[model samples]
Target: MAESTYTVTGMTCGHCVASVTEEVTKIDGVTGVDVDLPTGAVKVTSAAPVAEADVRAAVEEAGYALAG
Candidate 1:
């Protein structure tokens, strides 16, 4: 498995974290997602190769943007 941590912006509360987590979980190979709202960080665990672009897209789809 592969793990990565990304900085996500616009996550102000628990609901924001949940939204991102839920959306990211839908992507294939995504085993787990841990969203830290206070720090705006997202930790992801995947069974296979996962791209940063994929994670960014997922977060954007959930109404948030990946921090540059």
Candidate 2:
């Protein structure tokens, strides 16, 4: 499996984490999603390397922003 770490902004609660997780998990090849609310850290595990743009879009769709 491949793993990638990203910083997500605007997540404030469990619902935010759930939203982010749900959107990210919908991506192709994504095996799992772990979100750290305190740190805004999102770790994505996938069968292959996922594109940053795809992840960004997913985060946006969840009403969050991907930190640069």
Candidate 3:
């Protein structure tokens, strides 16, 4: 499994976490998603290395921003 951690901005509550998780989980090959609201950290597990742009787009679709 390939795992990646990304910092997402604008996540203030559980709902934000859910939204981000829901969106990121939709990406092809993604097997799991874990969001830590307090630290704005999102950990994604996949069968392969997922593209950073794909993660950024998913986060944006969930109304968040992926921090560099």
Candidate 4:
């Protein structure tokens, strides 16, 4: 398995986390998601390394920005 951490912006509440999680969970191979709204930290665990482009797109789909 593989894990990656990303900083997502504009996450301020439970709904924010849920939205991000929903989008990211759609990615193939993703096994888990952990989001810390206060710090905008999102840790993603997957069966394989996930592509950066896919992560970014997922974040966008959730109405947020993935920090560079």
Candidate 5:
């Protein structure tokens, strides 16, 4: 498995965390997710290779922007 961390901006509360988590968890290769609200970071564990574009799409669908 591999891990990736995405810096998400505009996550201001627990609801934001839940929303993002749910959105990201829907991705095909995602096996796990950890959201740190204070840091606005999301750690994703995957069983196989996952594209950054997919990750970015997920975050964007959740109504937040991923920071580069």
Candidate 6:
């Protein structure tokens, strides 16, 4: 599996985490998603390397932004 970590902005609670997780989990080949509320860290595991644009779109769909 391939793993990637992204910093997401505007995530403040469990609901935010859920929203982000839900959207990110929808990406093709995504096997898992884990979000750390305090650090705004999102870790994704997939069967193949996921595109950065796809991750950005998913985060935006979840009403958040991917931090640099």
- List the global CA lDDT of all models: 0.91, 0.98, 0.96, 0.96, 0.95, 0.98
lDDT of 3 by residue, 1-68 (tens): 99999999999989999999999999999999999889998999999999999999999999999887
lDDT of 4 by residue, 7-50 (tens): 99999899999999999999999999999999999999999999
Pairs with steric clashes in candidate 4: none
Candidate 6, residues 2-32: lDDT per residue as tens digits?
9999999999899999999999999999999
| C-alpha TM-score for every candidate | 0.95, 0.98, 0.98, 0.97, 0.96, 0.98
Clashes of 3: 0
Cα lDDT for residue 62, candidate 6:
96
Question: Which tens-of-lDDT digit does each residue in 1-68 have in candidate 2?
Answer: 89999999999999999999999999999999999999999999999999999999999999999998
Question: Where does candidate 5 stray beyond 4 Å?
Answer: none
- Which pairs of residues collide in candidate 1? none
> Between prediction 3 and prediction 5, which has the larger lDDT?
3
* Model 1, residue 50: C-alpha shift (Å): 0.5
Per-residue lDDT for 4-32 in model 1, tens only?
Answer: 99999998888888899999999899999
Q: CA shift at 15, candidate 2, in angstroms?
A: 0.4
Residue range with the least summed lDDT across 10 consecutive positions in model 6: 59-68
Stretches of candidate 3 off by over 4 Å are: none
Off by over 4 Å in 1: none
Reference-based lDDT, residue 31, model 1: 95
In model 2, the clashing pairs are: none
lDDT of 4 at 57: 97
